[model samples]
Target: VLTTFDLDEYVHAALRAGASGFLLKDARPDELLAGIRAVAGGDAVIAPALTRRLLDEFARYGSAPTDDPRVDRLTEREREILVAIGRGWTNGEIAARLVLSESTVKTHVGRVLAKTGARDRVQAVIFAYDLGLARPSVR
Candidate 1:
């Protein structure tokens, strides 16, 4: 997505609509092409300048991790795995942190995605963010 608007709300809407990448209209030609290629390759991207604000929005506004019923179906262990996924941890990282095998972590992740109705890891991450189960670390 290339647009002149720098508003956070629009960015959020686009992301919610499954935009694989976002770039400002002012982005360099190379950057635009790369973003397109990355999106085409089934990766997501966000403009560098908007990344901090996007993270901040998650940190500043997130609430109700405990109260949300969207996570009600998850087991306690699965919830932990979801939070780790939301923190952008790899399966290996989650395995190390949780003292579990990589296969176990992968299985937990699959269960989390299925239980939460998330189509993929990226959707699971978004779900975690929306449910306030994960947060960006403040520096």
Candidate 2:
């Protein structure tokens, strides 16, 4: 369960399977506790990236999309950060583009990862692509 699935469909399947709980493989010890408690209480939990995709899929299939509080948690600044990350820009590049300090950009990236349940920038990039938050640049 500690493999590199940090953002894979298996995690969603694990939740649907009523497992005691499954962590993102990179979850900190403290975060693991929350997962255990959630499943122990018979609740299903999914990473934000997966949640977003599921909602999008539902919308695509003509069903009502699920309401996700995490989407609301994202600030306008964070949305801009995601778009930058989606563009495959390095933190330094993002800082320069947004006219923010590199350290501030790093902090924003960290917050985005935590809020989006993204294991790393790579996954966040993939999530952004999947959600159409950013288009792939011309090769």
Candidate 3:
């Protein structure tokens, strides 16, 4: 987890560096605690507002999604899980929605990250968007 106000540039850098959560310094006590717990539980966390802003910024500079050979390595199930991750769904949410066990979802998520060369869940989410597997709706 990273507690910093440098969201503009460092957020992406931190995630790429394998940091699981990014929380602003001004986060409330409850939010900070939750972020830490989420990270400790092997889950990724980012403030919702920051997520939206980051997605919008990325979308502006994003390249047109094309056929990337890396994505071809994923199985159909892995691809689906990657898209779900890109949609900001938790492992529990994915498990419930896909009618699978949480452990199964975790396995698939790990596989997706491995196959795609993503360092973490955030990187996987970025990969999903970059590959056109998922599109972020900036609203």
Question: lDDT of each structure?
Answer: 0.83, 0.64, 0.82
Better of 2 and 3 by TM-score: 3
Of the two candidates 2 and 3, the one with more favorable lDDT, higher being better, is 3
lDDT of each residue in 70-122, candidate 3, tens digit only: 78898988889999998888999999999999999999998988898887788
Model 3 spans with C-alpha error above 4 angstroms: 1-6
Give the TM-score of each candidate.
0.72, 0.52, 0.81
Which candidate has the top score in TM-score?
3
The lDDT ranking, best first, is 1, 3, 2
Top lDDT prediction, candidate number: 1
Screening candidate 1 with a backbone cut-off below 3 angstroms (N, C-alpha, C), the clashing residue pairs are none
Q: Candidate 1, residues 54-101: lDDT per residue as tens digits? A: 888878885566566658889999999999988989889999999999
Give the TM-score (vs. native) of candidate 2: 0.52
Residue 42, candidate 3: how far off, in angstroms? 1.6
